[model samples]
Target: MFAAFDRPRISLRDAMAEALTKVPDVEIDPEGTFKYILVRVKDGDKQKDIVRGTKAAEYHNHIFDKVKPALEALGMECECLGGGKIEHNGKEKKIRVFGESTAFGKAEHSVSVEKLKTVFSNYEITWSDDKK
Candidate 1:
């Protein structure tokens, strides 16, 4: 009875071949470990999060607290629609202005563009009308 229990086991090559024939429930790493475990982040509604990265969030706050008021004081209707990113000086820079307004006329638009350029001199500003 002990002799029967000592029968030869399957070879490593043969065992690997057999395992490859069936699809596994979880992805296996090369080291024979599970690829990912306990995912916590939900994929729903990432817009707010994407728009609120560190620099962008700070810029957005500044716009709301200071820029908007300054522009409004100059008789320009300004709206803070949130923040985004832009390539400025060959580097990625976060922007605080991503809004639309019917308040900007031809002269006001030019003036506002100039004012924004002065305020954010280091950044490359792209306007809605494709003016930079």
Candidate 2:
């Protein structure tokens, strides 16, 4: 009867496993292990809508136009990879931006399709990484 009333004991390892849930952007491999983690923010459908019109071009330009001065103030090295304006009906509209940066770069600039859906809170987002 007394033993039945005792609290269940949890090992430190078990406690850590449970605690990991509170941390975001963590990956556990098939073998259930990880060495490091990375976090990044990405554009979503809302971002696309914001970047797909002449108005968007102006807004995005205004946002990035501040970048050069900021970088200069910080004395950071940055480079533009390559990007260009997109046109739908033969008028300059929208801008696609890409860049290389020492401060932040990822070899696999990828987000799990499922993860993107969750982050954007839009189930319509879809992608596939499998090559068949």
Q: Which candidate number has the best TM-score?
A: 2
Error of 2 at 113 (Å): 4.6
Q: Show the lowest summed lDDT stretch of 10 residues, model 1.
A: 32-41
User: Which residue pairs come into collision in candidate 2?
Assistant: none
Clashing pairs in 1: none
Q: List, residue by residue over 76-106, the lDDT tens digit for candidate 1.
A: 3433333322222324432222232222211
lDDT of 2 by residue, 1-132 (tens): 699659898976556444333333322221211111123222221111011112332332332344435433533332322122221221222111222223333212133323333434422333222211
Report the number of the highest-lDDT candidate.
1
Off by over 4 Å in 2: 1-5, 26-37, 40-101, 121-132
